[model samples]
Target: MEPTTTTPPEPRSRRGRRPHGKVRRRLAGALALGIGLLSVGALYSVVEPAPQTAVAQAADAATIAKGQDLYNNACITCHGANLQGVQDRGPSLVGVGDAAVYFQVSSGRMPLARQEAQAMRKPPTQTFDPHTQEGADNLAALGAFVQANGGGPQLPAATGEALRGDDPARGGELFRLNCASCHNFTGRGGALSSGKFAPSLDPANEDQIYAAMLTGPQNMPKFSDAQLSPQEKKDIIAYIKSVSDGNNDVGGSGLGGIGPTSEGVIAFVVGLAAIVGFAMWLGAKQ
Candidate 1:
């Protein structure tokens, strides 16, 4: 007979392997594993999403996120998580308005180093250069967040020198009656009770002046919209800008325009002359 034992039934291991079933099992497992790997990658993609798309999809949402991040880093300690404010640290920001936020934050009155009688307008903790893309966006984001919260005053849509009042004279009158005590006639800031002092209006822009008047930051008393009409505020700003932009001292050199400067100069000159005269008299006597 032919080699009837032709196949010793292969080896037991090979015999145990059903080629068809084994290949099918392997293909199915590989397909499942590949799908699982792809799913994992997709999940990772979702967890770390694309920034541009997120921003485009919901600009306001993105703004809120950015504002929240900034708030947490710089404001949470003083202002509570909900903007309620910490006792003796910061007052609740709610209902303070975007005008207040813009005035305080843009001017760098916020993020104060330590609690004081009044918050001073030093160089801002965060600067926003309108020329830069990122800075403008960040500033807008912060303003938006505050606006979204309790509503109050708001910054005007337009900003420019043209916004000033037609008459600087009228503006001057308004300033003297309302602002001269705190800020000098030329808008030079002055000392107040305690550590608090009114800051110079030199650095302030028109919008900032308007906002400050509306909000009344620190120890400065609030000037409501009713108290000072918008036109009056604009007039005050015009006067400030006119004086700040150039010397308004119609008389001799402004010399700081503080009353004491000229007084001191007169005293020095007079005293020196008197001393010289006294010395000459003593010499004649000798």
Candidate 2:
């Protein structure tokens, strides 16, 4: 009875209980925040689109494998086991890229049958023909193989008429400035020093021309995108098509389409022959 009286009804507010309540509230708030974050993360995982990066990587790996197989079978002899090239047999294909491969293989200038001053264009083997599905696949595989070894120029996605540009006049100007010296004013092609010669544009298709520009093939100077933009390249293709397809030409005859030199020669020959014939007729009359 004396102890209870002295204790005197310990202060109505219990400090211990207050602190415990505050701690419980803080723990509840923290648990609620954690649950909210976890729920948001779970929702995002279900809604987000599955990434295709891994699938793309797998496909790329398969393509590279097929290319490597083709290279080992056909190209390894000249290009070396690692594309470093053989001593005098073939140049290194390391940095040449798919554009060069397409040009050389598709044009039949590669798989060289014989060693010569310059590789001549011939009919491509059935395996490399772009017209057939099998051939096209094989060609792509081979190009991919070379491309994987070292990166370089690539061919345009378009083909044939699609590659032609809308502005032929501007293309003509560019052709004259850069290509006229070797290909002639009409894209007729001319002789160069050594055994190398500028190939006639007469036989070149859109793909070949585009590949040549990208790769520079042999003696031709490489016109990178920096030098000639893709649009400019297309324009050049248009000009070549216009001239070579005979859609655009001067007055008459075109004099073999070799430009003024052939025209001048023909003019002189015809003029001299006419003069001589008239003189002979006059002599006969006398």
Candidate 3:
């Protein structure tokens, strides 16, 4: 049998060097797991979002919700469900800024009574008054919503008297040069190119005035903070108040606040005239 004696029966490990089925299974499983992990890593990389973008999205969503609530409650009637505005009703508020909203709502010009050449200044609705806490919050939320959707001018944090300055004389000069064209030198609203006209500053508060300058509602041009410093804006407010009723007096005794000297002179002249008139009357009776 030619030494064929089973060839000494090949060793178990040396017979064709065959690997165990368990080893093949393990290798296949490991390869599958690695492939799956690589796929998962690539997916995560593609889906990951920036931290700031996520936060901003969340904030915008919340603001939009709140604004939708407010708009549904008050603005939907004329501004449409999506703020597209209605024909002959209200204009679209897409790009209008928080400043415009603050100016109109704070001054009670919105929720218009009827479609007219302009929205006249009146008493602010109970919900939109900037002076009140609730109204202020609502205004901010509403503004955020509008901004998130349309992107318009933004009002500064330092509103109202925070922007007021100390020099009324300078403010007066600035007003005469810049503001008098549209808003009369007296601050009473004036006519405009279109039906839209300048709303009177008499009804506007300090914050409202600042917002108006910043946003330039209607035909008014936007006035950046760079052009008019905070101090200058405050000074202009002071000048307006000095001329328009002042804080103490909505209608003071001073005729157009011609200063104390003029008032005193007028008073003296009137008193002197009265005394002379009495003397003349007595002489006539005699």
Choose the strongest candidate by lDDT. Answer: 2
Candidate 2 worst ten-residue window by lDDT: 1-10
Q: Please provide, for model 3 over 83-163, each residue's C-alpha lDDT reduced to its tens digit, 9 standing for 90 to 100.
A: 788988888988877778778877777878777777777887778777789888788787777777677777777765666
TM-score of each: 0.69, 0.83, 0.62
lDDT of model 1 at residue 100?
Answer: 84
**Model 3 segments more than 4 A misplaced:** 1-60, 190-197, 226-231, 245-253, 256-286
TM-score top scorer? 2
Kindly report which residue pairs in candidate 2 clash with one another.
none
By the lDDT metric, which is better: model 2 or model 3?
2
lDDT of 1 by residue, 169-269 (tens): 99999898999888988788889887888888888877788888888887777787788887888888998888787667665566665532555687699
lDDT (Cα) of model 2:
0.88
Over all chains combined, what TM-score does candidate 3 have?
0.62
Per-model RMSD to reference: 18.3, 4.5, 9.8
